[model samples]
Target: MDQPFRHIIALAALALPAFATNARAEEAALIDGGKLLLTNGVTTIEGASGGGLASWATIAGRGTDRGIGLSTHVTLIELPDYGWQSHGVALGLANRLELSYARQNFDTRDVGTALGLGKGYRLNQDVFGAKLRIAGDVVYGEPLLPQISVGVEYKRNRDAPVALTVGANAAKGADFTLSATKLFLSHSVLVNATARLTKANQAGLLGFGSNGNDNHSLQFEGSIAYQLSRRAVIGAEYRSKPDNLAIAKEDDWLDLFAAYALTRNLTLTAAYVDLGSIATFDKQRGGLLSAQLAF
Candidate 1:
């Protein structure tokens, strides 16, 4: 394990009991059979309950069947010329709301040397998020209404001077999102749509905005998943982004991913990611792996 990821795992291990406290009534049973498998989706890179690169309509918790679901995840992505890692914890309260916090580290790799920053300069960001499942259910909705959620993420970038030196406008920003998810159980397929408003560049990892333009833009994220079994899923996702920074035009992100429940409390995820370009690096294609523990 990497240093940052290991540190986060330690914290999560200590916090796990707190997140699972509400479920003591069921924990004693040791066999959580009532809660259907794979209902609590995998943790997104931003620490929200979602797909690999996009937020899903489903809440973080298991469902009404389970009390509280707390999850911790570590994601690492290796691009052709860039490296990124993020770790976070998400807590779901009664499957109705979610709270998440994440720390992201972006290794500039060769870009750092080109910019005279260092051989492998890193940009660190802290993100805090909250989400509310306002209506419907992803799996058990009646009359075909989709599950809906509203969310917000506040991002704080640590290296503002570097971003501004490179022609960025601001360093901190928040994104507001709305998501709707539906499950066609009979067909074994799931679909979701999400809308986000933001002015952040590179999802706030490259700062908030650039001097040329700083207006908040509406972005879209869509996902489709096919269930292969009770504990496994395959999905594809696309997330649009704003080209707010003049230093480097931003591009949309896409990924194909899989999530599997190894146990009621453990889930694993793997993905192939494509982030067109950043700063000056092009064809940023890579893979992502994440492990989640929830109860």
Candidate 2:
């Protein structure tokens, strides 16, 4: 790992043990899985809670205001020229704070050989994230107030050499996001909007910004969903991303997704995604499937 990445991990390591000890001492008082179904939202690509392509203001897990909860998920994506898989774990505290970690692998497949990087080459990344709910509630409290949150994600690219060779300025960077979300009980609809500041290329799979474009840019993500039943929802999401690398012309991502709760603790999500172009290859559309377990 790079020096900065090592420092980030070490800091988390030092704080986690102490927090875990305290949490264990109050385990009985802390864990109460009482949130309503699907209100906590599904896991996003980077492991935060929301739609597959966008993050929402809702926290992770099915925890109530006075409880702690855990969630885990695995996601897979199949594209014409690439393959993607990611898995992660998240912790929600008092339905106000969330901490998450995810690992992503992007397989280049035949495109790797065409680019002279050998067939089946892969790019890997690790994302560490934290979010704090600042106000309101998604399904309760003031009807139009909405839930608001601020978050940050630090991403580390595992293939630093390749990233540098491709003109990326750094292999590690951070993204800051602000989100607002609301659920209208009368209409059975949920809406969310998020603003992000980032310079990552392909969400840091290929790396951060190119040498020529190292500045972070503002982006937007929006989602709208309708509740079909108590346990099922269909949604659509659109996410704009920064095109910071000169070698690859990146594009915005959009998806139409459906999620169903099989049980109080398990939910499955499926989506048809259009990722646009990636690394000079066009029409990189695909299907995404994910499974999440929460308590």
Model 1 segments more than 4 A misplaced: 1-34, 63-66
Candidate 2 residue-wise lDDT at 10: 50
Off by over 4 Å in 2: 1-29
RMSD of each: 6.5, 3.5
Error of 2 at 205 (Å): 0.7
Clash count for candidate 2 is: 0
Q: Kindly list the per-residue Cα lDDT of model 2 for residues 171-211, writing each as its tens digit.
A: 99988889999999899999999999999999998889988
For each candidate, what is the lDDT? 0.81, 0.89
Model 2 scores what on Cα lDDT? 0.89
How well does candidate 2 match the true structure in TM-score terms? 0.91
Q: Pairing residues by index, what is the TM-score of model 1?
A: 0.87
What lDDT, from 0 to 1, does candidate 1 have? 0.81
On the 0 to 100 scale, the lDDT of residue 169 in model 2 is 93
